[model samples]
Target: MTFAGSLNPSFYQSLWQDCDSIYMQHQSNCLTLQDNYQVNVNLLLLAIWLDSHHQLLDSSNWQQLQQILLQWEQKLLLPYRKLRRLSKAALEQAEYQQMLDVELMLERKSQAKILRNLKSMALNEVSSTEPESNIGRYLTLFNLDSQDYPNLGQ
Candidate 1:
């Protein structure tokens, strides 16, 4: 179905910021997903946002979204995130903060790209027969359990 209008990127940014707060509150689990599983937290938040809006991506759309996020994660976010983490010990406080600001800027760019793609796509409406949550579907691709993570949408 067609979107009525373009989604505001700030809305997604707000969702991510709220989820990021939760991640900070529950750092260990988030760190595990980040460090061990390499889960992209922003993508998870996007899944939750889409589910909240009753939007469903067909398999092809879902795969394309994954590919987009994977490109951002692999080529940009991950390396910068790793550098940020590593720099915490090696760099001075001010310099590390600058790195963090830059990382956040990159994250905003990534989110905008995702939202732009979403705006251009034809998404399916969530059907009664599809009882699974979007976040659950997304996590399933990585063999993850929704119960293992904080509930951000509900």
Candidate 2:
């Protein structure tokens, strides 16, 4: 499918539906709800990125690109995410509005950093000749396994 096709709401919804099922299965006491939730969202965002750039990727560079993205997520995105969550919680008190505003800026900065890192990634410096395989590879990149979520299409 083209990037435009992938952007369709039904297509995105199916992707999230599958990812959410897998997340719930692995979301146990070992993780907080915030971290657990991020896993799915991050992976979905990664899927969107990969789909948007499918024509420029192939199996050879796909794994490497995922590693780069994962590292960026862990080092840059996750910390700011925690800060954002804290700032959101502080909203209940009303006095922390200014602090939340600062946190929002910091969080957006980290997000931009991650997006910058992503834009630097390339698939062997050439476009993939076979785009069909990109979706299969991208879907399984996070180990969500479409086979495990056969009902998502419904």
Best candidate according to lDDT = 1
Prediction 2 TM-score vs. true: 0.41
Candidate 1 local accuracy as lDDT?
A: 0.70
* Per-residue C-alpha lDDT of model 2 across residues 95-151, encoded as one tens digit per residue: 466555665565445445444444444432224454343445555655544444333
Q: Tens digit of lDDT per residue, candidate 1, span 1-154?
A: 6551355556445666665665565556556766777666666666766776687765556567778888767888888888899779989899999999998888788877776777767766776456766677777677888777645445
Best-performing candidate as measured by TM-score: 1
Each prediction's TM-score against the native?
A: 0.75, 0.41
Q: What is the C-alpha lDDT of each candidate?
A: 0.70, 0.46
Clashes of each: 0, 0
Indicate the worst ten consecutive residues by lDDT in candidate 1.
4-13
